[model samples]
Target: ARPCKIVEMSTSKTGKHGHAKVHMVGIDLFTGKKYEDICPSTHNMDVPNVKRVDYQLCNISEDGFLSLLLENGDMREDIKVPEDPSLANEIRSRFDNGDDMLLTVLAAMGDEAVIALKFNTK
Candidate 1:
């Protein structure tokens, strides 16, 4: 499942004694794809367990895999590049240029990887 952020919410009443349906409009946080859903107020939706963590780009393999160093001194080499082509290109470019990079990794539950690179202003 992809991560989603609700941008709008509207409710509609079918009758005097009926359930209220909520119309939710959301945009994909990464892909910027528009998504909309209508459901009862009592309906439960799946929310992705996401966390933001800092990672350092240690290396890049010939196959284009990123080797990241976590805050706890553990190495993670399986993170895929983010879906945004421009962001992905920027990340690689910064790594190649030997920039001081502090990557904001969006760790989503079990599969954790979305790179938001922040570089030193100097």
Candidate 2:
């Protein structure tokens, strides 16, 4: 299942011969693409389970792979830094300054990405 974040939702009043309709606009969580769907209000829809994890920013490779410090003292290096230019620049500059940072990673449908960053509170 694809994970999406709903950004807009609207409902239409029931017609004389049909049930109410629901319109939804969502953004693809991983790709930043727009998706829209319309269906009867009573239809059953599957919702994807998304997970957010915060890991210590250990290192960033020249090729953009992120080394994340996991809670179990292990390192995760498979996730890459995002392609957004502004965010990527911010991350690289802050890390180069020796700041302790925490990366917020969002995961769904066996795919994961670095979505945000925060200063380490400790």
Q: What residue runs in model 2 are displaced by over 4 Å at the alpha carbon? A: none
Q: For candidate 1, lDDT tens digit of each residue in 1-122?
A: 56878899999976587789999998766567899999888789899877888777788788877788876899988877777788888988888899877777775546566658887454
TM accuracy, model 1: 0.83
Model 1 misplacement above 4 A: 14-17, 120-122
| Candidate 2 residue-wise lDDT, 1-122, digit = tens | 46899999999999999999999999999888999999999999988888999999999998999999999999999999987787788999999999999999998988898889999999
Q: Candidates' lDDT values, in order?
A: 0.79, 0.93
TM-score of 2: 0.91
Error of 2 at 86 (Å): 1.2
Clash pairs of candidate 1?
none
